[model samples]
Target: MDEKFLRKKSFALPKVNPFIHDLQLSMKDKLQILVMSFTLAPIRLFLIFILLIFAWLIAFISTLGLDIDSKKPVRSWRRLPILLLQPIMRAVFFCMGVIWIEQKGLPASRKEAFIYVIAPHSTFYDAVPCAIIATTVVAKQDLISAPFIGTLLKTLQPVLVVRHDPDSRKKTIQEIHRRASSQNEWPQIIVFPEGTCTNGKALITFKAGAFIPGVPVQPVLIRYPNYLDTFTWTMNGPGGLTLLWYSLCQFYIRFQVEFLPVYTPSDEEIDDPKLYAENVRFLMAQALNVPCTEHTFEDCRLMSQAKSKDLPMEAGLVEFSKLSKKLGIDINEMNEMLDEFALKSRSCKDGLMGIEEFAELLCLPITEPLKELFNLYDRDGSGKLDFREYVIGMSLLSHAAVTEKSIKIAFKVFDRNGDGTVTHDELDHVLKSVFGHDFETRNIYDKIDQENKGRITFDEFYAFVKKRPEYAKLFMTYADLEQDDMPQDKIHNITQRRASHALAGSSILSNVQYSNQGANAILKEKKDE
Candidate 1:
């Protein structure tokens, strides 16, 4: 990669750090907030609390004998108190400075669309929509235990979701499908399909819960048109209390809710809920006048992980949906690779690895071949590797070629001294023995033996082999070429035959006994394959 060319090349996707929002306050804005803090904030706070207490009292009385978790919805005369609670909730929003809400396009009737999908859910301020619609919502299970808020949410008969429970997601989806497909038995359910907050500059990937039922959905767009934004709460932004304090101090907050036309799925979309979700998201994004991104909530988890490991939080925003699709790697695999990247970049800063750190990671010196490999991974040729490039390069170069059997065979081949150690000469000797070729192994031994020992241990040999998976591929290729009758496509055939031939031949591995247990396991794998 040419340094100049790489610097000029544009990335495939625009970089949008949606997990962060840096609120800039001007002198005048600060003065206004300071004045309002003593003037209107206390009165707003008091009135808001009073409204919440009254709403909670009504909700508590109405839901006294109702089964909040019932498979059936509450109906008939029992819903009278729940009906009475809506205006009081609206009153709460009024006291919080959301005096009037601007609406565009009429909301869909329940018979037409039972699911209302909302987006750009940036803060608790989004609760304004729930109060406006007076409908049930999908919420986290923990919210049901909140002091006064619990009873209020229960009155809506929400579909509460539990985190970290294996069956919770499945149940949530099934419940959504049930409610959406019912015959006017349940109130329309509201879903925030982004599943988390963003800065609202772009639309992130949407979760499929709202579309899984193959039902028509109303897309609702939210906007905070305030001149000075104190409403965005993201992973690295202001906390809820701080944003609330600032919002309460504002003279007025402008909130707009635009309901797009009800979107009914086609046959293809009905068969694939993810596609249904993407189409709806694109429509909403176009209406909101923003671009759609492949970043998902999983990226936020990665950002948190990066912060915990002392890296820049933005380092983990890898456009996860796009990269994962292109690389054919899943989040679990990417997470494991992050730990390895953390180990290599600990001595570096800005969550990037320079040439020195790259060399250290591979247990090699800055030779031409090593630098060539490093440059291959440094996509932008900034002379450094970010976590995204590191993961792509490593998955492409190492994941397929490095396996448990290959590690053992390579370790056994390289440990030529029989004292369970390999010097530089032994590494070269094993390369020649296995591949009938010589490789430049200069300084590899000294680098692997960090304590300055002349020879490297088996663990060191194994680690080196893992980091350089291309060497394992080379060994396997030579073994395959040696036995032309062996099936080249079968991995176990190559590994099994290599171990047998190396042990039986009059060569470096002749005296070494390849484990029978390992051989039997390989045989079993071959049979299973």
Candidate 2:
């Protein structure tokens, strides 16, 4: 054999399954499959739809033929057929592979009579599960014209809705409420608050339309853990479906449904619909572990801190008006003065100092003199100043006779390492160097370390200083002088006045005299020796 001819030939590998590889199916492919399946394998769905129509028709015909009232459709005997129909609908859903519901928490009998707002992961698969669970005549105006499902859905007596028609939407809500109130049934009103669908990772902002009447909104958070790819259907990107054909072909995908605890709307929250919606949205977000745009703990803290100064101004106008009436000060004049103060105080340059340093710079102790100052700065009441709290506190301190320049210098000194905020550890170290001998360092540390994390936070430090007036007074007095602008006239006047007062009183001078009596006694004993 020739060397070239003897060389081995390679064979091409077989193609892998595209169904396993593709993340989301295209709309065109899904529709084609749905049409073909409906044409060929229409028996199960067709029989179910026919059975449901026959059952409803029989009820209608019996009421008419037997002279039974149409308005009062729920006669004792009529309930049997409706009860039988529920299982049929459930069977259809099971066959479709939509959901396998497992109930937890409070039992159905004891559940405080309320609305169950079902939120399934937005998908066409959601329809079947929603239909199975829904009790109070589930209706969707949008789904009235939907392909094979539309005729069946209409026959089921769903209230049709027109999205842009406000009047129609309002009517739908009223009708739903009426039905729910009259019929004692668990109406699983499936509403996608996002108003559109996306991959289950993100939740769109909830619209407040459904929650208006302050009905308890039970949030049912569903997760499709096993088959996420099979469940997603959108109108955008690779996963979306625009035409009717796309939905049916995509219906065979397997899914899991989790019904989270119901969220009840508060009576107090009814008037503020937006706020109510936000609360529900927040709860849903928390349950889902998704990020919520609603106000959080941190948000509230920030708002409180920001509005602290405005408190006096916002409350001051009314308070000052009352005080002015009682104190007999001109309300207009006080208001003008307040405005001026507010304007002058707008510069937060001196606001960067710590509360202790600011107090010291003004020669004010953390005693009764600084009570208002403490309250103004201690936003959370934890006692110590965080960086923001410290800054605001310094601003308040500076207003009490400490010049802006002096306040800035004092802040720079206190903020030793120059991190904007003086943390508890830095404050403690400074305190240890200054007043460690006054109290046992170990005991002081134990008291200040609230978390026992081996370091103090600003709140802890503040609490410690507040408890000891003597130490606070001494610290403040020393800190006041650290600032360069001790008034020259004040120092000179004090020195001169003290000298004149000492000269005027010989007794005062004698009290200051140092005695050498013991020294003289020792000298006499040495001479005798």
Candidate 3:
């Protein structure tokens, strides 16, 4: 990865913060420190865990005499230890000499219980102190048993949800309603609606659970300001304990917390929790000045897994099986069939497919589904499919959920000039490259040119995709859409191979051969080129 190439503002630069012009760690220093850091970490990790257990144990022990269901505050004497414990924990972290959390927002007003939603959950520690001040939080049942953090979380009275059980989602929501509506002293409910963590680089989709309560939401954005990426949890990078070790090496880790104004939804929005959640997620992303993505928690989970699987490999070319492995699939079942495409797709005798080889792998008479997959995966528009591109394409196709954001991003891959439109020439070039013939996509072009303008804007392209028949299997969607328009050819017979491959199936695609020049044939012969 060249830091000089196409670096977006969204990706945090690997340099020091101008405000903290201290000498950053060198690679060798980091390795040396990383090894030493963990040796000291277990003690620190254990100390923090004990601090949380004691704080909660004391708070709960003090509260036993009071009416558990009362909304009224406990006697100041009882509250004193609980309040003092939070600050003491903060001081302990500060004394540990590695991290400092700077919280800027005024605590949520106690007048009314509101939903506190946090963003940019980069590490496991992102939600800690805010969770303290915000009172209680909604969490999974497993967190209670999670080492070091579990006892502390239990003190917070986290509303826990079960996984994969019947009525689990409903049960979780009901718990939220109970806690949010309770007259008892359950602190305001805190939730990380993004449902997963990131590197503070992007804000992905938010889960809808937070909005179900239909109450005012207090949105908080958390950013780990770092010269060393203490914020990111990488796939193949050091494991959690090692990352913990690295953070322990930070002379002082600082974070920025911004509390946006409370957003009160209208009755209409309250009734539509999905709409409400999306609106809030969008607002937070805008406030953070990051591009909003349509990826969900599942997308992050799968991508993280795929990244881990490849982290051990060298930087460049990867095997076809490696590509499928990232997508969490075994392609050996289809290897016999894949061999045909691989032979044509591999640009080098090294048996690896680069972008160009993959993009232009198939011949003429391509189907809609395969064409869309190609456009989605070609990435750089250089007519190649590397390991990364291949995984993303196959993941989305296999997952069967195409987000609007993904569609918009993928559509631009075909708009070669970056002019916001896929021009006739652009489509012509792509089709010719893929099929090895200048087959006219006249009908397809006309369909995509919704305004009959001879060009396809992203909106037009998106519309064309949205209108694709959902019934068609992964790669066969478009095949069914234009079966009537396709030319008669023996090579066109491979479109439904996904079904034959059984459980470890994939998008249906076929090899194509153009046997007829036809009147509209724009294909060039070998000599013509």
Candidate 4:
């Protein structure tokens, strides 16, 4: 499948109707009802157990009769039963196959912090674990009565958010802010910005009411690695909720949760909550790779760890010798070739070099075979190459040795305008084509695109090139090298290694892409150290 199409398909999810908001007992209502009914027996048993535990604790405290409202009494003796019951409930839920937890990145606080955004797996079953772990206050419409968990959540004073009106949203924000300001405790308010359940693929459109400005947003990703048939209540086919109830009844699945680091939206960026939600959703999606909807905070955390595990021991190594061998050339020779090309490609100060001289400077004996490739891109008779032409040219040259299609994909991307030539204005565009448009790249462009014309002219391009001659040299030399007789597996290994190295180098280059400001800063910091 085409990569773009695959990406689109992977991210697709069922859309929730806005009209459902008006209905009292909508799908969410029905799901909740089913969950309550199905778990009615267990709920009653658990309630009885809770009552017994509570009664025992109260009786024990009554014997003291020494001002039970005191902090010392509450913290020391009174809190014991609840603390003890927590693990018991967690274990019960785990055994019941109802929920699991996965913690990801380090939290800002190991003990206490206010702003917490919990993303559950979007099912009544999944909600149990999230409610248990995060102490989530469920947001419900005023029409529905609070269910068993809802009553429990209310006791925790988790924010009870109502969603039908603008006035209510504003009031909700105010209440949250007020609660946050007054709280000395760490109960987090959990909101499902996607607003509805999905198939764990595409994320729903986020409602930004809960993400107040200046508040930290901690994303949690959740994943069910087992059979969805036995684990999830939100599956598309028949036996969906039934299977969920059976699974809950039988207790037969495992779950993983990942917690990502807390992210605080900048004051300036917070005005647009939708954008804030989208950014968070995007981060979560990218971390999980299964699709935006499939990801939750827990899934992201687990995925991060999984990816970290997959990283090779030599992932960070830059083996220049191995790279040289793959290119079938001496390292020093290739460097010389690159240096010479870089010098020749330099623009004439007074336009002294004519077209023939320029051609001579650029022409290579090895470029003969590549010329056929270049000619295929020269759709226009213009002697000079454009972004599109150059991209095709490079892609053809690079395709012989690199098996990863991403290299060619990068080439095509650099030719953003679909034009046949690349101009100085498109230099950053080319860089973005290769490296992703990540934070580092954004920083690079913000600094380099000083004129802000959105395109880099030749002068700007030359300045960038001079600062990162290594990349230009590497590409030129790689393009010039002959094919090697390495085994397919070895070639794949080499390609992967090179790609990683390239990404690292590009990151370093991005830091220096603008001027030498960041480079000088680094040096200064090192000196200071």
Candidate 5:
């Protein structure tokens, strides 16, 4: 699928530059991760069995007298079974230590059918719990495969879909449109618009299918309080049964479902479901206190495949080798900085530091350059440094800050044709992302294309960046730039500036795109301890 079409405009990736919000877990929180890992709870295990038995019975009884096809009002006496059985299920939830939505938290009026959107779905519990008040759920097509549960699943009346299949998507949308338009008999449509489960720490990009019906949506945000984070599904993590057993072991599983004000789309928003969907996602993310990842559900699922092999879904942890390789830095140097970063951190024995700690990293006399490096590489502004961001940010600050090899590697990123040369088209592709202008692209090309052969090889590009003292100085900070050729007086001025620094190296910050904080100015060097 074309990304532009699938993507939501309002789902912005936050920047981690100025704010140093480290995801600090309290001592209690840290202990939760430990307890859940080691302890086995037999009490909750038994409770889950009881709940399952009751759940099956409730499902069958709840749908007994309803004309599912008939357009009946939710308040009708026919839905009495559903209403009565919901509280019984909720009692089972209480026994299982499920903390869910309160009566005061639900929409004041329950008469109207709402197209509900829920987010931060860590497990099936996110949806199953909604039955306490609402009935219908939008599930996936795979539900048909389950033999026994297939019958019980009928109670939810989920709008199951096969992702990425157009026919399935069309059918599901038509179903929703028809039912939403129907006055009676339709259960409120509950959709997990993110289309997959997450760890609840971050909001992934939303799918637009939920908004396609052009109905007002009641956005619900779900949060599972966990330290070890056994709730959300992962690629290599525990399976559903394993997760259920693990949750049973926890001291208690507490989850919250917050129903925000109903979001009625304006005429403009109705026409653009993508905008409406993303805007709703943005609102949910803000309420949940999580950042937005640029990845979609399918994107995260694919990423999880690679992570399944060896990479854990650890927060603020990146592989040292991968980081070194991407930034073209020596692994040893990156490792050294990582060691120092952990030492200076409050609780980084794990070798991970929040982006704020990294911003304040004091290996170099000037921490400004380090912060600038951090701001540049901290793409999502997650306020914390993952392995990749840490490696790139610190590698640039280390000795090979902006050498010929690094510069060449950077250029190759824009060398789309693999021609060992960067043509105007390639430069256009690159500079457009950086400056977002063709005029600047043309200007940058004219300056670097020393041969004027309509393109520039690595050699010409290197020479263009090398002679200027500004290139080296800029390398010491964030956001690199090009300069006009220097006269002898300018060269002499550069010489005087370098002399005044009285250090082994003064000019380091190169013109790679980086975040611009107070540290954007490069002043001194990273002293060798």
Candidate 6:
């Protein structure tokens, strides 16, 4: 899709640029890095490392002999060391040039909200909020194995989650629910609902675990209002060491945290955890003054897939979360479909399908009918179909309309002479039946009649329909009109009317084209006047 067109138009959902971050350095910035490498960077690293060891030692003693997997909170005496460790942890950040943290609004008490949902989780520096609050976090289970950071993270008794394990996700949710319902027995938990870092231009979809318990949650926003951004840790951004070097070189990193009001879920939100999470995310994005996007961690996986397939990494960013919700498809299904898409698009330069590739994939030659179908998928008039467009067309225009029964009925309707074969006249009749007019179909018929016998058997017809499933909807509509024993003229009129309605309902491209044509026609009439 054209980025300019996307920016100029108002879309149902905002455009997402959450996963890319490019760091461009100026001469002054380079000089500062050179200067700080010798001066402040060395001192900061030394002091921060020392403070980290002290903090880790404190955490080690505090967590000693305690069951790391315990569902219950630690005893009161065990919590005392954490209180001491918090100041040391704060000092570590201070040494790293986070001299001060500007906080806004009051944080909710444990009784008011057992969960705090943080957003715009863009960098490792975001740990400042965790340190300031001294709350437990939902961390990766693998973090427990990290050298010094592992001991420190364990000290907070974070809810450890294992990615790629369905049972682990279930247990994490169950554990969150348990804590929320424990009535002050457990410490307040903080969740970065995005589950991954972004470039911070937009807020991505929030995971529902924190909101699942139906308890009150305080939405927190983190911002780094700095002139130079060396903090955002995105998949396309600078490496951790590069960001760390840039960050350490800076005299002080500006950080701010704003706590929104504690949100108590209503009955509706309680029942629908996804709704609760979305509402909370929307509120946070509003506070951050950035758009909320449908992008999620799933896009990261898709981006990786795109890269592996030699397509632009952004090609796989099909706003999978939103498409899944609308189309009722899952990531695994999309992944499988992507493999098919890759095969069809292999001849194309950009990993997208043009009209030629579209025809080749369906085993049909280019014709007006094929062009129409390709146009339906070539949304944005870009003359190509991206993965998102392909998926949408497949879901709404093809799969939903193309079924075994419908295909059989349409094929029978096309075989007028009942000789188990369809000739050119019958193919033309089939097109006229659905389109209400003639479409040059010599190419279409020849493509289907691979044997060059001037006739296509039922197998050929079925194969053609299978390749172009979008036609099934129109074919079935025509078959229905034929079953009613309508006159050809009457069938044509009804088919024309119904075709507009069916395409309007099933194809987004249809709406875009119709709206554009309608506006053009209106303008032409005005000029005539």
Which candidate achieves the best TM-score against the true structure? 1
Question: Model 2 off-target regions past 4 Å?
Answer: 1-73, 98-113, 131-134, 142-151, 154-157, 179-190, 237-254, 292-529
State the C-alpha lDDT per candidate: 0.75, 0.43, 0.54, 0.43, 0.54, 0.78
**Which stretches in model 6 have alpha-carbon errors above 4 Å?**
1-13, 346-349, 410-468, 471-529
Reference-based TM-score of each model: 0.80, 0.40, 0.55, 0.40, 0.51, 0.78
Q: Candidate 3 local accuracy as lDDT?
A: 0.54
Report the Cα lDDT for residue 458, model 1: 69
On residues 1-529, what C-alpha lDDT tens digit does candidate 5 reach at each position? 1122112233222442111113345677657646755644565556656776776676666656644333344455535555655665666565555754433256523344368788776676675445566657776677745754654556656677887677999888888887788766666777887676656667666778878878888887776655555455644356776666555555666676677888888898789998888788898889877776544444343234323333333322333223333455443454444445445453654434565565344222223334444555454566565554454443443333356654565556557677898888876754343322422456556767766898688788777555333233333221122122234343333333332331122233333322243123222221110
Model 4 lDDT, residue 358, Cα: 33
In model 6, what is the error at residue 443, expressed in angstroms?
Answer: 16
lDDT top scorer:
6
What tens digits encode model 3's per-residue C-alpha lDDT throughout 463-501? Answer: 765544121232232223123344423213322232122
Q: In model 5, which runs have C-alpha deviations exceeding 4 angstroms?
A: 1-40, 58-84, 99-104, 108-113, 225-228, 304-529
lDDT of 4 by residue, 273-333 (tens): 7668778878877776644432222222222232243422111111222233333434344
Q: After superposition, how far is residue 162 of candidate 1 from its true place, in Å?
A: 2.4
Q: lDDT, candidate 4, residue 375?
A: 42
User: What tens-digit string does per-residue lDDT give for candidate 1 at 233-258?
Assistant: 99888888999999999999999999
lDDT of 4 at 145: 40
Give the residue spans of candidate 3 off by over 4 A: 1-53, 56-85, 96-101, 131-134, 146-149, 163-166, 234-236, 304-529
Report the poorest 10 consecutive residues by lDDT, candidate 6.
Answer: 2-11
